[model samples]
Every structure is written in C-alpha cells, then in structure tokens.
Target chain A: MDPVREVEGRAYPFGLKNVDTDIIIPAHWLKTISREGLGEGAFEALRKDENNVFDRPEFAGAPIIVAGDNFGCGSSREHAAWALLDMGVKAVIAPSFSDIFSGNAFKNGILTVALPQEAIDRLMEVAETDPISIDLENQTVTTPFQDRFTFEIDPFRKHCLMEGLDEVGLTLERDSAIAGYEARQTGEMPWYAKGTALSA
Target chain B: MASKPRTLYEKIWDAHLVERREDGTCLIYIDRHLVHEVTSPQAFEALRLSGRKVRRPELTLAVPDHNLPTTARLDEKGHRIPIADPQSAQQLAALESNAPEFGIRYFGATDIHQGIVHVVGPELGFSLPGATIVCGDSHTSCHGGIGALAFGIGTSEVEHVLASQTLLLTQSKTMEVRVEGELSPGVTPKDLILHIIGTIGTAGGTGHVIEYRGKVFEEMSIEGRLTVCNMSIEGGARAGLVAPDEKTFAYLKGREYAPKGEDWDRAVAYWKTLKTDEGASFDKSVVIDAATVEPTVTWGTSPEDTVSIGGEVPAPESFADPSKQKAAQASLNYMGLQPGQKMSDIEVQNVFIGSCTNSRIEDLRAAAEVLKGRSKAPGVKWAIVVPGSGLVKKQAEEEGLDKIFIEAGLEWREPGCSACLGMNPDKVPPEERCASTSNRNFVGRQGPGARTHLVSPAMAAAAAVTGKLTDVRELR
Candidate 1:
C-alpha cells in the first residue's frame, strides 16, 4: 500500500447521517469471492435513482466522501470500506464513525476524519461546487473556497498511514518479542495447544 | 490513602495491555480470535499474498454461518449439505481451503460444532472469563457475557490478529447501565435490551464500552445474558460486558474447552476477581426500571426505532433532533407505518425466529412455549425457525420444540444464520413486513424492500398466531 499523505479532489457532497454499511453496499453484493470491481456495486441502491450523487458524472472518481454524523453505523462488513476504496474514496469527512468501520477503513488506507457537525455542514456546502483537500500530515481539511478545518487523530494511526505500514508490517517489526511470548505461552498452557487439547 | 477507582473494563483492559505507545494507543494481546465465512476471505487472501502465516493458529476458530443455507439436503454420509448458490459455495470453499493452509481450525457445514461463530464459542467453551476475544463479526461482543473483554473487529484487524495475535488499539470510555427490579412475566432479556436501545437511541453508546449491571442481569440465565450482550453493537457500543458469577462458571464447567481437574479450581479463583471493585467509577451511567420494559419491538429502520408492542408509532416530529426526525420519517415511509398507529394493529406477512441474537435453545423454547398446540394465523404466509447451531437444532428437536413449531405451521429448519442476513434462499419478499427475532431492522437487512419489525421469539411466535405484532403478555 502507498503512503496516504494527502488527498485532493472533489468530494461527493452527500451529507446523509447514519449512512450504514448496508447503504454503502448491500448484502447481496457481498456474495462475490473477489474483492475487485466492488465500485460498480458501491451505493447500488442509491445509484438506482439517476439523479443520485454517486451516478452524477462530475463526482465519478471523487476521492473523498463528506457525510453526516454516525456514518458507517451498521454491520462489520469490510465490504463497505472496500466499496468506498474501489470507488476511489481516499478519505471520508464525517461527524463521527462507527469504530469498527473506521478501523476497517484505516486498514485499507481510507482516511476517516471526524470533525464537528458544524464543520461537516460547511464541508458539505463547499463540496457541492468546489474541490476538497485533506492533509493527513497536518490534520487539516481544506476547500477551494479557503474553508479550513483542523481535526485530531491518534498520532500512531497518522504515523502508520504516512509510513504505509499495515498491522502485519508493524507486527513483523517486533517479531523477536512475539516469538519470545509464544514460546512462554506454549510452555505455560500446554492444555490450550491445538491438537493436544481440543479436536480441531 | 484512597485508591483511584477503576471500572471492570479498565481492570480487564489494563491486564491485557502489552505496551503503551507514545501516541496514547496500546498494544493488547488477544486470547481468542473467531473467524467466519463472510468477512474473513479477503483477510486470508491478504495474508496469502503477503506470505504471512497465522501467528497463533490454535487460538483462532473458523466457521460458516451468515451465508449458510439451513434447508439443505443430507448427503451420503449424513452430512447436511447445500451449495446451490455458486457464490455461497465459493466463499465456503475458500474458508475450508484457507483454514487448513494457515493451520487455523475450520468447522465446515457438516461439522456438528459448525454454527454461528458467537454461539459455538460459548457452547463449546472457547470463550472464558478474563479472556480478551475478537472476531470479524460485530456480534462478537456476545462473548463478553462470560466476563471477557470481547468486541468485533474488521477483516484487516482479523488479519492483524492472525499475523500478530494482538491488536493495536485506543481504549474507549466506560458507561454503566444498571437495570433494577424484576422483569414482568412474559418479558425476556431481549425485551430489556430493546427497551434500553430505544431509550438511548442507536448512537447513544458511541465511544464507550457499556457495563450492564443490577439485579436483572445478575439473575438472567446464561443464554439470556448472551442475547443481551450480542446486540450491544446495535446500541452503538464498542462492547458490552457482564461481571461473571456462579452462573457463568456453571455454564462453562465440564464444557469441551473448559479447564479440567485441578485447573478448574485455579481458574475459578481468578475469575472471581474479575469484577469492578467497590467504589469504582464510570464515565457515564444510566438506570432502567425493569418493570418499565415490556415485550419490545422495533417499528422503523433502526434498532432505536422501537416501542412497546401496545404503544403507538411515534411521529417524526416527536424526535427533538432534526436529523433524527428526518430519519424517522424515512423509516416510517419504508416501514409502511402511519404516525399514531398502534403497534398491535400493524400486520406482518412473515415471522422469522432465528439469528445470532435469538436462535439459541432457550430462545427456541420460549417461542415453542407460546406456539404449543397453537396454529399460525391464516393471514401469515411464512413462519420459520432456524436454530443457531446443529447442536441447538438437535437439542430443540430432542425436547420436542421442533415438533411444537412444526405443529403450529412454523417450519422448523436446520442450523445457521438463515433469514437473519438473507444471504441464502430464505428471504422475505419485497414490501412484505416481517416480525423478526433478529437484532437488526436496517432497511433491506433481511432482503431488498423487505420491511423488518424486530421482536422477541415469544412475540414473533405470538405474531405467527395472530398475524400482527401482538404482545405476548396479552396472549398469556
């Protein structure tokens, strides 16, 4: 995965609240074995209306989604994040996010930026006619009209994102410590070992 | 000197902390990781591509539930089987192939232990007190009933745990919810939780881990506790936990994975200390009168859109928040309900009694008790019961719960998360309203354009009999 220092593009001006994973990508679309091409199914229900923003040609490759509060509120489906990424959504501006969904988005290199509702409202307006830019390095979101909003993020997450480090890569960095712990665990709890204790 | 107070969540959380990072986040080791067919395939594929193996395969268990078809035929060796849906077949096949490749244990559809990941973990003793558990499914919080620090994770987190056996995390603030008094007859744990969700709204528990206390939770049966903890996500909580007691120990004793002989005594000694100490504090607190909770049902698109069975549908204007008001109007339109319409007057074409939330043996017995010698209403088109696990199915059948449901015109089917997710053949037709025992009422959660009314198993059974969302207490 490439480092995501900044994302600059027109954002989908959708400000709908509690836009759940179901609305992001319906359960039926989750049936496919491959993760590729989910963009076609992204917002499948909303895109049915010809006038919907997802189908609007101007925002076709928008790299950001400016949504309302409690975005991604249902289901632990990573498909929601996959759909967003496939649709080229590099960052989501919302009042808040469901922790599980935010975690999923983070792992997939989609930045979830939480701002106050007023800030989200302002962004929603700016996104309607202007492009938006997000700088993860500075923790600030800006619009072509000079609307600037600074946000707070866990510094560790920001570091990982800028460094293009995933959990696996992070863990492998501490491989020696993990190996030591595993050896101790095996010795102390032999009953909990796989084949010896429970039939798998 | 006075000691600083700590919640049960903090105590457990602090115990599992491996390292505190410079950025206010910590690395916490995971005791157990559960995997399912739907969310894990992509994670496993990522691992394969990266050439990384599971760090601790023994600690992870895999099962197929969400996309499983419950009405499949038996094969030559007496294994219940179905794979007609090509996509479902491929997903399950991927899990089967991937589990062995990574040395993670896979329980296929044919295995008796194969069930909903949450249910199988507890019934088979994989979830234990003081353990930190996670899964790719949100309802993984269900194991917190055993006093474990359990919550859901995304597929990437699943891959992270598989590769490192730990999650890098930021902790959540703690909220305490105390339910006082005794529940009214015919009201179950499901009613209590739905009542709480309705009171708090869907996002009320955001950024917090909720601890359910008071006499009601203490007195609740193990299965009832599981039912309550399973829906914590619907309340927008990262997780919900109950301090384990004797009932918890009794439920685990002698189970397949539970400690044995001398280890049992030592384990119980430690589990007994897994509670919030006296004078401990929470960031927030709420109190619910158990008597106020009735046979609850959701009448809208979200779990928070719920009310007592006898109550009237709330008008959108009743909500103080404008966004909530708009959401309520949309929900009312989608649910095909009118403001001020009594919940009891709304009709339902189907009654589905199964999900990770309410598909256990006790849930089956509750519905069976209501359906005994009673036939479904003539207006009801489809009434079905899908068990959570094969063992639960076998237990229900042995106790004649299946016979009662079958006699009542409700189809008693095999074990899996069937109509709950609608990933398989079982589905509610478009525009048809259903009284469901599932946790979610999200639009199209059951099927496209299918309206869902979240109700308890007993109420769903009663609805099957009366063809509307009738209060079980009235029938009693």
Candidate 2:
C-alpha cells in the first residue's frame, strides 16, 4: 500500500444511491486468483451501456467518485475495492457508506469521505465539469471553485492511510501479547482451543 | 459497587479485547476464521508472496463453496469430475493446495463435510457460543445465530487474519431489534427478516451490531434464527446476535466440535452467562410486531424493495426523496414491474430454494411440505433445491425430502452455494425473474441481468407450484 495523503482529479459524478458491490464488480469477475487486470471488469454491468459515465471520455480513469448515500452496500468481496483501485478510483465521496465497504476501502488506501448531503450535492455539481480534491491529513474535500467541505474519519485510519502502515506486520509486533492472551484463554476456556474434530 | 450493565455484544467484545490503543482502536482476537474459494485465493497468494504462514491453522477452516458447481462431482467409477469453468477450477485448486500447505484443515469439494461455510460451521460445532468468527463472505453473520460475534471481512482482512489471529478494530454500537407477539402460521423467519429489512431499509443497521430480542426470537428454532441472522449484512449490520439459551446448547450438544463430558457442562455454564445484563443500554432500538409480518417478497433489485405477498408494487413517485424515486424507477425498470401490481400476480420463470440463508434441513422440510402432492406449474421453466452442505443433503435424503422435491418437478441437486451468486453453472438466465430463497436481491446476483425476488423456502416452493409468486397461506 502507498501513502495516500491527497487524491485530486475529475470525479465520476455517479450519484446513484445504494450502489452495491455487485454493481462495482459482478460475481463472474471474482474467479481470478490475482488482483490485477480487474479494471476491465469494474462496473461491468453499468459499463455495458455505451453512454455510461464511467466510459465517458471525461470521467475515464478519474481517481475519484462522487456517489449518493449508502455507496458500496452489499457483499464482502474485497474485489470491489481491488477493482476500484485497479480502475484508478482513489477516493469515494458519499453521504454515507456501508461499514464493511468503508473498512475495505480504508485497508486498500482508498479514502472514503462522508459529508452532509448538501456538501455531496455541491460536490456532484462541481464534479460534472471540474476536479475534486480530497486531503486525508486535513480531513477536507475541496473544489477548484473555492468550495471546501470537511469530513470525519477515525484518527487511527487517517494515520494509517498517511503512513501506509501494514496492519498485519504491526500486529505481529505484539505477538507476545497475543500469546499471553491465548495462554490465559487456554486456562479459563480450554474448550475453545479444542479443534472441531468431526466424528466419522 | 456495581459494574455497568452491558449488552451481549459488549460482554463478548470485552472478553476478546487483547489491547486498546490511544486512537480508540482495539486489537480483538478472532476465535474462528472460515475460508472459501472466491475471496481466499488472493489472500493465500499474498501470504505465499510475503512468506508468512497461518498464525493459527487449528483455528482456521477452509471449504470451496463459491465457484463450486452443485452438480454431480463423481463419475460411475468413483473418480472426481473436473470443474467445467477453468477459472473456477483454478480457484478451487488453489484452496485445495493452500489449506494443506498452511496446515489448515480443509473439507474438499466432494467431502461429506463440505458445504457452505456458514452451514458447515454450526453443524460441526466449529462455531460456538461467545466466539468471535470472521469469514471473507458476508453471510458469515449466520454464525451469530449460535451466539458468536461474527462478521464478514474483505480479502485484505482475510490475509491479515491468516497472518495474525487478531484484527485491528473499533467497537460497534449496539442496536436491539425486538420482535414481540406470535408469528402467524406460514410466516417463516425468512419473512420476518425480510419484513424487518423492508421496515428498516438496507442501511438501517449500518455501523452497529444488532441483538434480536423478545418472545418471537426465543421461540424460533436455531435454524430459524440462523436464517434471520444470515441476512444481517443485507440489513447493513456488521453482525446479528441472539444470546445463547438452553435451545442453543441443545442444538450443539452432540455436534462434532462441541465440548464433551465435563467440558460440556463447563461450556454450558459459561454460555448461560452470555446474555445481556438486565437494563443494559442499547445505542438504538426498533420494535416489530411479529404477527403483522406476512410472507414477504422483494419487488426490486435491492433487498429493501420488499413487500408482503398481498401488497402491491410501490410507485417510484411514492418515495419522498428524489434520489429514492429515481432509484425506485430504475429498479422497477430492471425488475420489469409495474406500480400497483399485486406481488402475487407476478410470475417467475425460475425458483431457487436454497442458500446459506435457508438451506438447512428444517428449510428443506418446510419446502418439501409445500411441494408434497404437487408438481411444478407448466410455465415454470426451472426449479432446483441445493442443500447447504453434503450432510444436509444426506439428512434430506434420509427423510425422503429429495423424493418429494423430484416428484414435484424440482431438481434435487448436490450441496454448494448454487445459483445464489451464480459463480457456478447454475444461474437464472438474463431478463428472467426467479423466486429465490437466497439473501440478496441485488441486480445480477443470480446472474447478469437476472431479476431475483427474495422469498422464503415455502414461498419459493409455492411459486414453483403455481409458476408465480403465491402467498403460502393461500396455497392451503
């Protein structure tokens, strides 16, 4: 993961609400073992339409998406996140986001900005013809038209996005603490460590 | 001095907390990690590239469900048949190799133990009361029915859990979805949850864990509770929990992985204390009258686009918000539905009576009961019943449910998540509508351009018989 401090570009002004992961990337595209080359399949269903905004020359390869409320609302397939990154979506600005999708996006260094619908309405307007800029460090989304809207994010996630921290590696540093907890659990609740040995 | 009365979620959260950071993020230990073919191949690849082994292989279980064909897997000579789709074959092959390489136990594609991860977990007692379970698939919330703190994770988090048993997390707020009153006959748990989701909308439980409370849930069978909890993701909750009770213990008593002898008694003692303390506070709450819930079905692409069997399709203009109105119009277009059309008047070409949501033995029995002495209507082109697992299929066979289904003109197929997401060969053809017992009604979930109307098992059977959506109550 790369440090993601700022994402500034023309945003795909797709304001469809409840855009689920299935729409982001369908199940057929999920068979690949690798994460690369998913850009071709990103929004494959919507992209089938010749006039879809994603395929429009102005929004092609845009690094941001301005969507309606409850964006990325179904399925836990991280392929949705990987597909977005593969297609160069660095930030998604929505009024709200589903919890799992938001977490997946944060993990992949994609910034998710939640602002009031009024701010989103303004962003959607500016996104039609102008570039939108998101600053993770300052927790703000700004437009070239001098419009600035602030957002909220977990402080830890912000730090992680800025630093490009490897979460698993960091947790491995606390290996001793985990081992200690396991030791305690073994004594207190020994049944947990008993593996599910199926009877023949 | 008395401690603060805590919710069941808080109690489980406290028990699993390993460390809390200054930023308010906590490292919580995952007790069980379930892996499947689709979301796990990439995670294993990442692990191999990073030269990291599974931190706790004993705690992990892998099975190939998604991308697996529910068709016959063996030849007459008892040789294994190859998967038709090359990409799917490779994905399944990767898990077959990765599990053994990482020292994790895997139920192979043809193993009697192999099935949907959610169904396999509780049936084998791999999921237990008060455990924290994580899986790459969203329906992992189904394990919460057994009183676990379970939620779905993405491939990145799947890799994280593989490399380390703990995950960096923030605590979720608690919500109580309390349902009172007795459920009317023929109103299944699937209908109850669909009605709940219709009331609360898809984003209703976002950022919170829901604890189902009151008499309705208490009387529901473990399978019924599992069906309700399975769609918690569709409702936007991270997980849904029902506190462990005597029924939960009874359901687990002699299962393969449940504690034994003295351990069983001790486990039960601990599980009994897993309930919410009286007067515990919830961040939010919603109450539903169970008797009011009807046999429900979805009318549009989204799960929230649901109505009772007797209700009419809502007009797009009926929505107050312009965005919603636009969405509703699009959904109606995709679903080929007209406003004011009765739900029962809509015809379906396909009927799928299986998924992690409703593929257990109980669900099969319910559908079989409806299909007995009946056959598929002439207009219904395809109808199939896929059990959740091999064991579930065996149990259904022993009970002669397969005969009932076959006699009624529905294909009694092998076990896998067939036609649910259409990763396999089973799929509802484009532009065709299906009455599905699966969780999601999202566009293309059953296949590209496939219109899915989510319904319960019995309701799906009813549709199969009538070749249209029919209220099960009216079938009698």
Candidate 3:
C-alpha cells in the first residue's frame, strides 16, 4: 500500500445512492485471480450509456468520485476498492458508506470522505468543472470556491493511511500477546483448539 | 452495584479480545474463517507472494461456490466435467490447489459436503455460540444466528485473518430489533426479514450490529433464524445475531464439528451463558409487530423497495425525499413496472428457489409443500431449485422434495449458489422478470437486464405455478 497524504484531482460527480458492489465491478469480472485490469470492467453496467460520467472525456482518469449516500452498500468484495484504485480513483466523497466498503477502501490506501449531504451537494456542484482536494492529515475536503468540509475517521486508520503501514506485520509484531491468549484458551476452552489438532 | 449488564455482542467481544490499543482498536481472535471462490484467489496469492503460511489452518475452511456451475459435474464415464468459462475454471482451480498447499481444509466442487460457505459453516458446527467467525462474503452474517459474532471482511482482511487468525477492529454500536407476537401463517422468515428491511431502509442499520430479540425470534427455528441473519448485510448492518438457546444447542448436537461427550455438555453450559443480561442496554432499538408482517417481496432493484403481496407498486412521488423519489423512479424504470400496478399481478418468466438465504432443508420443504400437486404455468419459461449444498440436496431427495419440484416442472439442480448471482451459468435471461428466493434485487444481479423480485421459497413456488407474483397464502 502506498502512503496517502493528499489527493487532488478532477472528480466524477456521480451522486447515485445505494451504489452496490455488483454495480462497482459486477460478478462477471470476479473470475480473475489477479487484481489488475479490473478498471476495464469497473461500473461496466453504468458505463453502457455514452453520457455516463465514468466514460465522459472530462472525467476520464479522474482521481475522485463525488457520490450520494450509502455508497458501496452491498457485498464485501474488495474488488470494488481494487477497481476504484485501478481506475485511478484516490478518494470517494459520499454522505455515507457501507462499513465493509469503508474498511476495504482504507486497507487499499483509498481515502473515504464522509460529509453531510449539503457538503456532498456542494462538492458535486464544484466537481463539475474543477478538481477537489482531500487532505487526510487535516481531515478536510475542500474546493477552490472556499467550500470546506471536515470529516471524522478512526485515529488508528488515519495513522495507517498516512504511513502506509502493513497491518499484518503490525499484528505479527504483537506475537507475545497473541501467544499468551492462546495459552490461556488451551486450558479454559480446550474444545476450541481440539479440532485443529485432529485436522492436522 | 451489580456488574453492568452486557449485550450478547459484548460478551462475545470480551471473550475474543486478545489486545487493545489506546485508540480503542482491539485485536480480536477469529475462531472460524469461511472461504469461497470469488473473493479468495487474490488473498491466497498475496500469501504466496509474501511467503506467509496460514497461522491456524484448522480454523479456516475453503469451498468453491460463487462461480461453480450447478450442472452435473460428471459424465457417463464418471470423469469430471470441465468448467466452460476459462477464467472461472482458473479461479476454482486456484482454490483447489491453494487450500491444501496452505494446509487449510477444503471441500471440492464435487464433494458432497461442499456448499455455500455460509451454509456449510453452521451445518458443519464450525459456527458456535460465542465464536468469532469471519469470511470474505457479506452473508457471513448468517452464522450470527447461532450466536456467533460473525461478519464479512474484504479480501485484504481475508489475508489478514489467514495470516494472523485475528482482526484489528473497533466495537460496533449494538441494536435490538425486537419483533413481538407470533408471525401469521404464510409469513415466513424471509418475509419477516424483508418486512424489517422495508421498515428500516437499506442503510438503516449502518455502523451497528443488530441483536434480534422478542417472541417472534425466540420461537423461530435455527434455520429460520439463519435465514433472518443472512440478510443483515442487505439491511446495511455489519451483522445480525440471535441469542443462543435450547434450539441452538439442539441444532448443533452431534454435528460433524461439534464437541463430543463431556465437551458438548461443557460447551452447552458456556453457550447458555451467551445471552444478553437483564437491563442490558442497546445503542438503538426497533420494535415491530410480527403479526403485521405479510408475504413480502421486493418491488424494485433495492431490497428496501419491498411491498406486501396484496399491495400495489408505489409511485415515485410517494417517497418523501427527492433523492428517494428519484431512486424509486429509476427503480420503476429498471424493473419495467407501472406505478399503480398490483404486486400480485406482476408477471414473472422465471423462478429461482435457492440461495444461501433460502436453500436449507426447511426451505426446500416449504417450497415443496407449495408445489406438491401443481405444475409450473406454461407461461413460466424456466424454473429451478438449487439446494445450498450437496448434503442439502441429498437431504431434500430423501424427503421426496426433489420429486415434488421435478414433478412441478422445476429443475432440481446441484447446489452452489446457482442463479443467485450471475457469476455462473444459471442466469435469468435479459428483460425477464424472476421471482427469486435469493437476497438482493440489485440491477443485473441475476443477469444483464434481468429484473428480480425477491420472495420467499413458497412465494417463488406460487409464482412458478401462477406465472405471476402471487401470495403463498392465496394458493392455499
């Protein structure tokens, strides 16, 4: 994962609510073991229209998406996040997001900015012709028109995004704590670990 | 004062906590991990690239469900049939090899035990009360019905769990969805959940874990509870749970992965303690009259766009908010529905009676009861019943449910999430409306240009017989 401090670029002002993962990448494109090349199929259903924002010339390769409430509401497919990143999307601004999608976005170094609908409406307005900026350290989304909106994020997630930390490695670093817990579980709840040995 | 009463979720969270940081991020251990084909290839590939072996292989179980074809997998000569789609074949092959290489137990496509990961977990007793289960699929919440703290994780988190057997997390606010009174006859668990999602919009339970409470849930069978919990994701909740009780213990006893002898007695003793204590508080609460729930079905693209079988399609202007109105209009357009049309009059060309949401033996029996002496209407071009797993299929056959479906002109197919999503060959044709028992009525969920009306198994059977979205109660 690359460290994400600031993202600034033209935004696709797609304010559609309840945008699910099936629409983000669709089940047909889930066949590949590889994560690359998914941008081609990203929003394939929505891209059918020539006037679709994702396919329009002005928003091509846009780094941000200004969307409506409940963005990424269904499915736990990280491919939705992977597809966004593959299409050069660095951030998504919505009134709200599904919990799983938000977590997936953070893991893949994509900034998910949640603001009030009024702010999202304003951002959608400014995003039509100008680029928007998201500053993770400041927790703010700003447009050139002096419109600024502050957002809330988990302190831990914010730290990881700024540093590009590998979560697995960090968890592994606390090996002693994990081992200690396991040692206690063996005596307290033996059945929990008994199945593993039988399988082995 | 007595110790602060805790919610079922809190008890599970405390039991699984391994470490906590100053920022409230807790490293919680995962007891069971379920894996499927669609979302796991990349995670396994990442493990290979990083040279990290699975930390606890026995805790993980892998199976192929999303992309496996539901057709026969063997020929007259008993050789394996090759998957037609090359990409899907490669993905399935990857899991077949990856699981063993990483020392994880896997049930192959042809294995009798193989099924939808969510369905496989509970039936095999891998999902237990007070356990923390995670999978790379949204419906992992299905296991929560058995009182486990199970929720879905993305592939990156999938890799994290595979490598560490733990997840870094913050606690979610708890909600109680209490449905008092007995559900009226003909209103199945599917209808109850659909009605709940209708009451609470798709994003109603966002950022919270819902604990289902009240007489309605307490009386529901484990299978019914699983059916209700399976769609918690569709309602925008991280997970949904029902407290473990005698029913839960009865469902798990003597199962393959369940504890034996003294362990079973001890496990039950602990599980009995997994309920919410009196005076326990919830961050939010919703109460619904179970008697008010009808034979519900989704009217449009979103699961929240639901109506009772006797209701009429709502006009976009009926929605109070501008955005919701626009969404309603768009949904009507996509569903090819008229604003004032009767829901029971909506015609369907196909019928699908299976998915992780409604493919258990009890579900099969429900559909069979509706179709016992009837045949699908001639106008219904295609109908199929795909069991959740091979074991479910065999069980249904033993109970003569397969004969009932086949006699009703419905295809009794092998199980593996068939027709639930468009990932496999079982798809509803373009422009066709389907009465489906699967979760999600999203655009193109069944196939491109396919319009799906979500319903219960009995309702799906009713639709097959009538060639329209008819109420199961009406058939009686």
Here, model 2's chain A TM-score works out at 0.97
- DockQ values, each candidate: 0.56, 0.74, 0.68
Best by DockQ: 2
lDDT of 2 by residue, A1-200 (tens): 79999999999999889999999999999999998888889999898899899989988789999999999988999999999999999999999999899999999999999999999899889989999999888899999889989899999999889999988889999999999889999899887876644342
lDDT sort, best first: 2, 3, 1
The interface RMSD for candidate 2 is 1.5
Q: What is the TM-score of chain A in candidate 1?
A: 0.91
Fraction of native contacts (fnat) of each candidate:
0.52, 0.73, 0.68
**1 or 2, which is superior by TM-score?**
2
Which residues of candidate 3, in runs, are more than 4 Å off?
A196-200
Q: Pairs clashing in candidate 1?
A: none
Residue A63's lDDT within candidate 2 is: 98
Better of 1 and 3 by DockQ: 3
For DockQ, candidate 1 versus 2, the one ahead is: 2
- The TM-scores that each candidate's chain B achieves against the reference are 0.98, 0.99, 0.99
Q: In model 2, what lDDT does residue A101 have?
A: 96
Error of 1 at B426 (Å): 1.2
Which residues of candidate 2, in runs, are more than 4 Å off? A197-200
Residue B92 CA error for candidate 2 (Å)?
0.3
Q: Please give, for residues B184-252, the per-residue lDDT of candidate 2 as tens digits.
A: 988999999999999898999999999999999899999999999999988999899999999999999
